[model samples]
Target: MWRSLWRSIDRFSPQYFKYILNELRGIKVVERSNRELVIDILQSMVEIVTYGDKHDPIIFEYFMEYQVMAEFVRVLKISKNSRIEAPLLQYLSIMIQNIESDHAIYYCFSNGYINSIITHPFKFEGGDLASYYMSFLRAVSSKLNRDTLCLLVKVELVS
Candidate 1:
């Protein structure tokens, strides 16, 4: 359904991004079968945001306004297995790397959202989860600049 709509339109609209975000947030239960659906939606959102960052700022703005990253964190926390968590981290890496605006980078790193994901307890005994985690860190590091570095790391004042 979403693939058809995406191909039908020349460019994805903000409304479509909103609808996908709603679907992302509407996941009440995460069964084995539905994990694929969630991954698909996340993949679609990654594409949407990537396209938006290049072509349409409004789409990306809507994505940011809808707090999609926070939703991703929610899904990550609920999904205990590595199968689901791995792709979420991969898509998150892509999104973070594609984000060009400083404000968006700040939003991504703020609220301990990324921090929470960073601190998430994933069972990485032997799988690609560890690799994906490293890639996600690389993506975040790729975006680091003088302005955005402070958001990811805290430099507290000792009184």
Candidate 2:
């Protein structure tokens, strides 16, 4: 049943992604009103985007046009209390790891979005958070190559 549903993705629409992105953007991280909802939305967004990357580049591009990567970073920064950090990292890692296309990977790694999240001073005291953090790092590391190197490092003129 699950595989059938997963494979029957022709009905999936970009409007679904846009609606979820709107919900994600509206979520107030500090307020505990919709914590579980936020996590669920993150998982859905990642799943949709990952599947779209492999099945339909147009759907993935539509999601990216909304600046989802940068929004994820903003959510991570505001979610300093670790309420949703672990799951966010886990989903992010999963998403990044599943990106198969070089163009899609470049879109994710571009604009220093991933760099900001990686270098952010996240409170990694808990085992789960630390583990997911490392997982996220490993996922990002796997995507690194000569083309994506510029996204992570800056070359300043010293002269």
Candidate 3:
């Protein structure tokens, strides 16, 4: 469905891509009877966020929107016991890096989004899962371009 939508969109209009991406991102949060389908959709959305064309500001803006942030956080929160956890974390980390590379402001916004999501009241049950998330954040923070990191940190601290 999403592939067909993407193919149908006029590539010249970034807004069309943004609309499709937002809808796919929302699927990650929907309660579905078929868990496999949900996982597949989430995986596809992550891949789009990570590797889709960087020339589109609408794509980047869609990612920065709160709905996409919520879906990403929900995935990180709920996928702890699944076999896909490691790969999902890796994909998320790459997505974070891609967003950061494209816009420094988004780096700070996403970091805050992650921080808020993880620090919620419920206890996360899996030690390995928690460690993977922490490691991803640490890796991203360490490897971020120095100037971008400075800007991210400043915005994160202030906001």
TM-score of 2: 0.87
Q: TM-scores of all models? A: 0.87, 0.87, 0.53
Instruction: Give candidate 2 regions above 4 Å deviation.
Output: 1-11, 80-82
Give per-residue lDDT, candidate 2, residue 14: 80
Clashes by residue pair, model 3 = none
Writing each residue's lDDT as its tens digit, candidate 3 over 9-124 gives 45435465465555555554333353455556556655555544355555555656645666656665654335445555666666555553546334535456556543544334
Q: 1 or 3, which is superior by TM-score? A: 1
- Each model's C-alpha lDDT? 0.83, 0.83, 0.55
- The model with the greatest TM-score is 1
Q: What RMSD does each model have against the real structure? A: 3.5, 4.8, 6.1
Give the per-residue Cα lDDT of candidate 2 at 119: 88
lDDT of 2 by residue, 1-159 (tens): 778767644335687888889888986663466777888888988998998989877778886788899888878877745477888889999999998998889889888888898888877674667888899999999998899988788979798
Better of 2 and 3 by TM-score: 2
In angstroms, the error of model 2 at 16 is 0.5
